[model samples]
Target: MRHLMASAALAALVAGTAAAETPKDQLIVAFNMNNVLTMDPAAITGGEAVQILNNVYDALLQFDDEGRNLEPRLAEAWEIAPDNMSVTFHLRPDMEFASGNPVTAEDVAWSFKRTLTLNLAQASGLKSRGYSAENADEMFVAADPQTFVLNLPEPGDPKMILMYLTQAGIGSILDSKLVMEHDDGGDMGQGWLTNNSAGSGAFSLQQWRSNEYVLMTRNDEFWGEAPAMKRVLMRHLPESQSQRLGLEQGDLDVGLSLAASDLKALEADDDITVKTETSAGFYYLAASAADEKYANPKVREALRYLIDYKGINAAIMPYFGVERQRVVNSKAFGALSDPGYALDVDKAKALLAEAGYPDGFDTSIRVISTQEFLDSATAIQGTLAQAGINAEIITGDGGQIYGAMRAREFELLVGRGGGGQQPHPDSNLRALVYNPDNAQEAGLTNYQGWRTSFFDPELNGLIEEALVEPDQAKQTEMYETIQQMIDEKVIPIQPFSERVVTAAFQDNVQGLMVDPWTTRFEGVTKGE
Candidate 1:
């Protein structure tokens, strides 16, 4: 039966439907990043790759178009325990995976457990940061095939539950049958489904030719509103100019992360509708707090003052400019009162002097080899020079640079941190700053190693308290206190700028929903 359904779905994909004739229209999106890795949603982590994989996989819970939490693709509804420690979800009985197997509570439980185990083994570096690993044991048991109960160690916060459920790491549900079948001689680590997908989602992957294109077709057995378009072709045009050219030539229906200059030209085009969202992320320089030379708070603060966010925003991202004072939505959790870090040359000089560098110290800034980052690095280099700091800018490919940052291999590095639609201060703090296991040795985001004796313990207590409070006002207050702590400590230099750029065909696309944290590409369709 499962094979029959899979065959039928493949047949439908082969028989492509015309966009003009169908109520739903197929969208061909071009992005700058190449899909070089596996399609298994659980294994991949890059933003662009995950965004593409989202269509092919269904998470247990997902946020809606408005950023309001919604029980969409999988679970029907969920209830939080009175103590706020546990959440029980009622599954949709009729839903089935693309493989024609029922999506039971066991599958959900197994998926969660598998991901948690994987995180412990493969992603220990990230798990230690309090992203998704700590809550594994809290998810107690699946009561039955359709109902599951998550038992928290304590009265866990509701926000933490929501954050964890929606996080990309634990979001993708897996099929136990498929997973077990793919295991090599019962070795769970060698599961075939690790690289392939067999879950319930709007679209199923049909063909993928690395660095070229990946094609997905609508799942006819999809339990929800059947997609109008028959297929979605995700093209990998790694070069920015080629991606822009593809959009201009009508070879692509949408372009992700359109260059600022290219966006200006496309915005003027009557056919294309340009959209910008204030990303829940920020771009900043991480000076390794763990490194002896750069660990000094005074030195780190001096670097913050030397960053001319205003100049960088104007020169690099003129279209959707944002101030350095505001770190995107994710980091904005606790930061209500702005302990402002302005670009003050005199103040920066004084701080450097206090750090025993009467003569401004020389340091190297490592940045991604992309044109945009290079431009920002150049501007920052000049800005730091004005503050009597001599800094050289170094560039490398994205993979190399990302690895370098993770290893904390530089004196100073330009990077972006903070993610999620509605992130909590505790979430950001744990992931970016205080996670000692993942702390960068040189200029990674955790460069300052600014750990208060009370930081982690207080955060854990506050998180638990916030979960049970249920009062929005009190939650806000708790969050504000966390933000105050971050600001006072100066964990990471919070130079901010709007991060995402999206464009669609104005005549064809409608009901488009954009959020700072996540993009809902499912409901979008071509107009009649």
Candidate 2:
């Protein structure tokens, strides 16, 4: 009924414009903008908010929409020191903010410094690398108007360092003068910039009604070629059916968040194209090591065979995510081939017997109530039952489900695997498996590995060793070894499907980014 209501309203708008075709000057993209909690780059979480910022901000460097290679953006070029302890970037001159102030080295320095000082969602990437408020001044240095220096704490790969900064966290440079002018009681202008933009990107935030829609207008003074669309509208349509209806009725140009069924139906419909991209992150089954039932590594290994990977991908996960068993995202370097393990009930039973659970046991799987997660958990429950493991499912919204997972209070959980914030292997590995401190009092639960209480001192050592290794070839080898180690160790969390972003858009809406991480409307053009 919610979908029907949204669809009916959009249909009425279409009826009002019966003679006009899809507007070429504006693009209406409807998606569930639940992840867009804040527009402030310092505090924004997840890929959805970053994608929105991509339109309004320019990073010093950015992974292309494909997220395969890092390319220069705000900065024209950069050079790394032989010791790999510092990188100096040469910024593109004659650049101006949307407010028409010159983008200087001071703005670049202050922008990054402010993020760390605020210590919000983006502070982890730098803080984890030994950069702190005390050291931030020494770390981020501005050489001149067009020159900037980022000093590393130790020797590391320049490639990975550049890749790390490519994330919206450290990379989204702000206009120092404009933002500071809007500062309310030293709040860093976060409150004001929440609805406004201060960057020099192709578009500027015009208006944003939380959980409703965000409206953006093209910046005529953009340094690069202006986007074809004069205005961009991202509507908050949570229901996939409503998005599909809007697209079919020509009310929406692109539907960013659609269910797998919606994508399948749209593919069969005329004047719509469904595009899927294997993006960062994964949907995985996690067994908490803190639970006695899952504490045994052998039990975790046995449970891996109970999943029907192919069946899930074909019938349920397509256009939602893909079957990928590798711990790291396949798009990252040194990602090993999937160790194909078909569902073997007998093998699972045999392993259970060997682990002294021949009679099997009862467990509950926790999952968010989203359709795809619930569907996957239901399938897993059925398979586990076949192996004599009676599993009950506990479903809730993200906060309720993931909140428990974060508090280290679940025996089993089906949750999304984060990392893929950047294309680097360390980015995924660190988030998924790296946990240096393990004591309950340590409060290191932010990491998935730590949240699961899956701690291995050696694995932690390897992660740190890999980060500082200046040799790319050697570092890649170390990561490959770490990947194998995690797999062989039966690292409590097992990834089943790599996330894939699927969207249905009008056939004439060209260059829509499927990867939510790098999505932007700057290059999107409408055609006949």
Candidate 3:
């Protein structure tokens, strides 16, 4: 009944808009902008921010739209030292910032320095690699106007470092001169950067009103090919129905955030096309190791079988993720393609009885209030109850739910995250399985393993060994071993599905990359 009212209102809205065709020289997109907190590259978090920043600022290197290989952007080429302790990048000589300032290697060095010095969200990737403000001068060096050298502070993979830089606006190169001129006191221009852009990319931020819209105009001084669209507007349309109506009415050129039902509807429509791309993350059920009931390995094992993976995937997880039991992304190197788990209520019951919970135990599940998350949790709740385990579903916003997980205070939670941005095994393992310090005072919230209070020294050592292993064949073997160890040991996070991002766009829109991390407006165009 409620859905009927929504559909009626949507029809009315579309009728009111008159199905006017959007301007050929402009692209209008709608997506949920709840996560776009700031424009400061150093302080921004989440994929939404990365999608916006990717066009406003240019990174030294970028992953291809399909996230398969590295491609050059600001840096024309690069070389790694034989010692594997440093990497040198050669900047393009013709690059200029939106303000017409010539881009130099010093700007690259300074941008990295500022990110580390400010110690914001973007600093975590570099900080995890042992790059700190105290060592910024030695680690980030500008050998010349076009040569920028990066010295590794730790003995790890330089390739992995490059991959980390390709995520979450962390590697954005700023126009240091323009940024400093707007600096207020010693904030490192962070205050000014929150609302401004000083990049050499194909687009420049014009105005951004939180939860309303983000307006970007093509950068006249862009170093690369000129953008086909003169202007791009990203409207904050959190409701999926609104996006569907807008797309159907030709009010929106693209819809980045739409519900599964809406996407399916659009897929059948002749005027719209829906594309699904593999994203970097996992949808998993996490158990807090600190909880007494879940502390037992047998209990954790029982919980895994109690989940109806097939049912959830078929019914609720469509368009959100594909069934993926392994922590590593299937597209990543050395990843195992097949999933090995299935629902076994009898086995779950026996395991629970063996774990001294023959009658089953009562627990609650923490999940975000979003449709997909809440529905998944509710489905899991039903499966657990079939095994005699009484489960309660507690729903809240992202901050409230994930906050409890980060504080290590939750019993069990349904969440999406294990970090697969880099097409490497360590990227997922580091976030999902590696926990060097289990002590609560250590405050390593960046690692999901630490957040769940699950730590294995042997697993940690194996991961470290694989990362620094020089031989490609040998490194691949070590990674396979690591995945086996996690599977055999039953880690705190049990992945049920690998995430995917789906978007619907007008059929005439061309060169639209759906992956948020690699999306760029420079090549996007509309047909008459």
Candidate 4:
């Protein structure tokens, strides 16, 4: 009976392998995520959702594989007005959305208006300079169906405004007719088009099985070079172990969010190819400044000193790319770096003493329930413990934890920030740290109620100046000052991690380009 059982198990494994290796026609990419809220290009914000959406939609402009700005899908040529407040785009007249409807300036205007409205409603986490609801209504006046004009309130900096439009969350243009036709009237809300996309992108969704798989086929009517692959199969494998196993067993051509430990072993395999890029993002701890104990600057500084970033990076991600002192890209927009605080246990202790907590304080570190974040929080807990700080680690669902952070439910929390292509420091500060309006219930990225009078005024001034300044020299100087200010004050501590690490079977995959600013799928192709 034991021999028979062993034989049966072996045969079962073989059968699974045969099924997994069925064909190269469907490009199965596994990701550690559950069912996404919506696949609509505009409404999608989470990491996994973006990955799936990129496969279906194309933006107005695209970032090259090297992270540089490039033109590909929608607009053919663009010119900025002499005063700098306006931009004119000549659209590609032949393009059409997945619905077979022509892509026009009206669609672009409608999409911009929807984003502006969503931003005003605080329903979506979209940010753009000179493109708010009020201005979008006035600024984006369509002169004709194929010609688009943007009139800025003030003479705006074209590059910065361009940066805003390129954000993956807002760049996708939706068909106005489809959106109006599909309003669901609930939390997913009156935008059927938000959950379902109709755009002039590279691929179109053929089938989506909730929590199971999403299948996409190349858009033969694409304006540019048609992809060589036939289909893209995205499987939701929420378990990290399962995703890793799928990659190893040749069942999945690509796997995302693989465990840090699994990366080393995967890199050793000759059949698989691995690539990683320094994410323009950071992992950091958010302490509730509203909390009585943490409101003290001394307490915050003490916690900063206690963190052993070097030790944590070495243990957690040995192949970690960068070690950030302040927030990632702290030097981007003229923010100052704080030279006073460094890794010093004794200094942390002394600061704790100065803060009226000589015995050290006990607090909880809240984190989203994910294996990757949990591992990172556990390492931090140990590091802080060594400094005499008692950190109780708590894990909960991501939505619940996000709400808790907003409600100031925990003393400290582990979170990440800066996931856009805009390399400017002002962009990061305004969206994540300085702007208080962003903390409103409707705002998307501002979970932590971080505000300081000094930083707030400074950021506002920078934005005002950046909008009008066309001189590259002056813009660079202003951004440097911004970075210097933020870094010196220790507003946020930036830790580093490999941003993009994806592997796929080399045999059938080609044009697998990853964009640093946003995940893109324009060039990806599967075997013919």
Query: In TM-score terms, which candidate is top?
Result: 2
The per-residue C-alpha lDDT of model 2 at residue 432 equals: 83
Runs of candidate 3 exceeding 4 Å displacement: 1-19, 356-359
TM-score of every candidate relative to the true structure = 0.79, 0.92, 0.91, 0.79
Say what the RMSD of model 2 is: 4.4
TM-score of 3: 0.91
**TM-score of decoy 4:** 0.79
Give the winner by lDDT: 2 or 3: 3
Looking at model 1, which ten-residue stretch has the lowest summed lDDT?
446-455
Candidate 1 or 3, higher TM-score?
A: 3
lDDT of 1 by residue, 185-258 (tens): 65443356444667677777777766766777787777778876677776776665765666666556667756
Lowest-scoring 10 consecutive residues by lDDT in candidate 2? Answer: 12-21
Model 3 collision count: 0
Give each model's whole-structure lDDT.
Answer: 0.63, 0.85, 0.88, 0.63
How many residue pairs clash per model?
Answer: 9, 0, 0, 23
Candidate ranking (TM-score, best to worst) = 2, 3, 1, 4
